[model samples]
Target chain A: MIDPVLHAWGWEIPVYLFLGGMVAGFMIISGYFTLKGHHKHSDFSSFYLPHISLFFLSAGMFALFLDLEYKVHVWRFYTTFKFTSPMSWGAWILLVVYPMLLLNTLVSIPKSFRNRISIFDRISDVINRYPALVKNIGAANMVVGAVLGMYTGVLLSALAARPLWNSAMLWILFLTSGLSSAAALVHLISPDKTEREVSAKADNGFLIFELLVIVLFLVGLVTSTRAHKQAADLLLTGPYAPVFWGFVILAGIVLPLIIQLLAVNHKIRHTPVAPLFVIAGGLLLRFVIVAAGQASVIP
Target chain B: MSSRYAMVIDTAKCVGCMDCVVACKTENNVPEGYNRDWIVQDVRGTWPTLHMEIRSERCNQCDEPPCVETCPTGASHVHDRGGVVLVTKELCVGCKACIAACPYDARFIHPDGYADKCTFCIHRVEQGLDPACVAVCPTRCMTFGDINDPNSQVAKLLTSRKWHTLKAEAGTKPSVYYLT
Candidate 1:
């Protein structure tokens, strides 16, 4: 059994973090596609991704809400903003995110759906009237999505108590992982040949960067104080070693990279298994980090 | 003048009976299966030269508390008069950020959905009485008073004895001192 003192945070936190990162990843992928004019090649990239992003983000928010002990008093989170508090910054960032996502979803409505749905038609008409506004929205999405991706890692790193989380590399690690997962998602869903090829290539680059970041993250921990070294050991040689090495490192990173590379080189046909492993790896990364960080605390 | 209250604990005199832990829980009404204070025992060296050190630990009530700074709604704050770290239940969102930021692991989630920790027994201190744990110590190992007052026991203990604080590298500047 885990020590009671270390149980302050549980499964709810990792689930929330996974969902939050996934949403941010989707936004970044969709924003990049829209900005680079790749949306014309794939209908899924242009219209459905932002809506899917919103749905995932809303679900993540619900998970966060469930973690709070006082659900009814959650409104207090927005009453005042504390600059030093990452939670406060996240709350404000989320407030801006919802509206931007909604507008993106409204503007990307397909003509078939817009014709069938009066509300979508009216919304799309308002958006079409201000053609220049769409450019600004796409730019805003990329900026906000990047921040949201890094913010998840910054939130944990800000906690000085957890040696495993105090490293600056955490933000970069989380961002690269988020990007890789987002690209993999697009690769899986987009039927357009050109779109899939571009996404697959981007995901391969992100996976390589993610592996480097993860290595740096662990190196930073192991080279620091005794407490930090102990934190690193929890994943390196301790009880969590098998999962960290087997599931997270080999299966999550190596296998996905191998599969994506083969697909890019046309050595093998692309399959859903590659992206599925990437997503699983992303979620496992958060869970291991959270659980091990808590376990490594000095009593 | 602002009063900076502090504690001076003599580790040599601590028997590790957990009286302070019991007293703190009772005085603070800490829920079952939770604790506001605990005793940590460190044993060093091999069998022939074995040496053991036991110390009762709780919130250090640091001067620059990370818990207060990380609290999103200002629920964790230092008491202005006596420098006691406290939690305002009404404002706490129960986000557990303070718990994560506290290196000492001194804070816990109360059943009422708020962060809870040792308040330095502010209710008793305000009435000019010793905190429950301090008052009930059989060995009189724990000293509590305004460290700024030259005449106070805690002040005299600090001046006369060699002392150290826990996790000095953390740079929190804890008010609680331990004498070996």
Candidate 2:
């Protein structure tokens, strides 16, 4: 007795996927920043990281709010928490991550100091008292982000109504796609100097992973039972043919591969635009997959 | 006024004329190309061994309705009487959280863009009339009554017959029961 409402396409799911992809990218960017010794770099964390994270986080929250049937009910999601639901997990993550990113930003401000001591230092001292709380919050956020990154695929796979999406690979594909999109996004958004170099390598690594995942995904689509096969055929040669081949395969995957190849050959650094293309391609792939999965008939 | 109304359906008697579907639409003034309630035929297995089952499902008007709980705007709500789950389209911002939470796809957004679903013809029921679906059914497949009343037809039937509801796994505790 799957809900009919879940079957249809609304704008919000794609929007969430897009934002989720970006967030994944930001996580990698933050990781890169930490690894590259940029954690101590003055302008990197102080000016750029906080503002960018806030901008995306706020926009993600806005998109989340817009996806709900009852927008006001979202407030209680935080106030009255449910530890069981994935949505609750996502809500708790946003709750901690948004504030931490913001506070981490504010504390970096030189003016936010008590004499030689920064306000963040004071805030950290207070939070450090609740060591369990801080650890739980970080753990919850990473778990939530990881889950949220892959749940979009699960949303489709949960439907027994759609055979093509019912595969176990759905989650893996989603995870890889999300990681690829995220890496590409970081490449697009970060400063063009050192961060760009860090993201470039990450992008290359993820692109290889994306390609492998796509191959496995295609193999599963082709080798499944008759119902799934027909559904896959619909995407391959039926009404959704052009969208499946054109947007998803060509522009989204191939074009970026070509751009990256050219960048490597020219001895020129990959521009932010190259990675942005990959992110856009990933988003387009999710969109097409979602829509096509719905349009597929069970015959 | 603390009255919870629900329908008990006899699936064996239902020929699937879909009178309930049409009746629900007309009575609710359901928008064109949208249904408040519908009969879905679940066909499973391959040829020569295929099985077909018809379920006339709408809002089950659950005792613990997830749609009501998950709604961020309180647009989707339950009526105190009959436990009818009603959506206030006027209040709905159309975020679709209710859609995802509902294990039964009893709710749909009409083309005009508001949440729409079967109301059990509350207006007529308020006037002491049977819902349009029950009244119009030639085979009397649908039985409407207050399950709380010992004398009600629903209560008697529940005691005597084997019954089931769609997606009992959802734990929605649907008021609509099916005696197949």
Candidate DockQ values, in order, are 0.53, 0.18
Residue A232, candidate 1: Cα error in Å is 1.2
Report, for every candidate in turn, its global Cα lDDT versus the true structure.
0.84, 0.66
Q: Using lDDT as the measure, which candidate wins?
A: 1
Best by TM-score: 1
What would the per-residue lDDT of candidate 2 be over residues B57-169, giving only the tens digit for each residue?
Answer: 78788887877765545567787777888887766656555655666666677665566777788888889999888899889889898988878899899999999887675
Assess the local accuracy of residue B87 in candidate 2 as a C-alpha lDDT between 0 and 100: 81
Candidate 1 structure quality by residue, lDDT tens digits, A1-299: 11124236788888778877877877777776666655555656657888888887888888888888777879989999999999888888999888877767765776567678788778867875775666666777788888998888999999978888989999888888888877888888877778778888998999999999989999999999998999999999998899899988899989989999999999999999998899899889989998888877653
Relative to the unseen true structure, what is the C-alpha lDDT of residue B90 in candidate 2, on a scale of 0 to 100? 61
Q: Which residue segments of model 1 deviate by more than 4 Å?
A: A1-6, A116-119, A129-131
Candidate 2 displacement at residue A37 in angstroms: 3.3
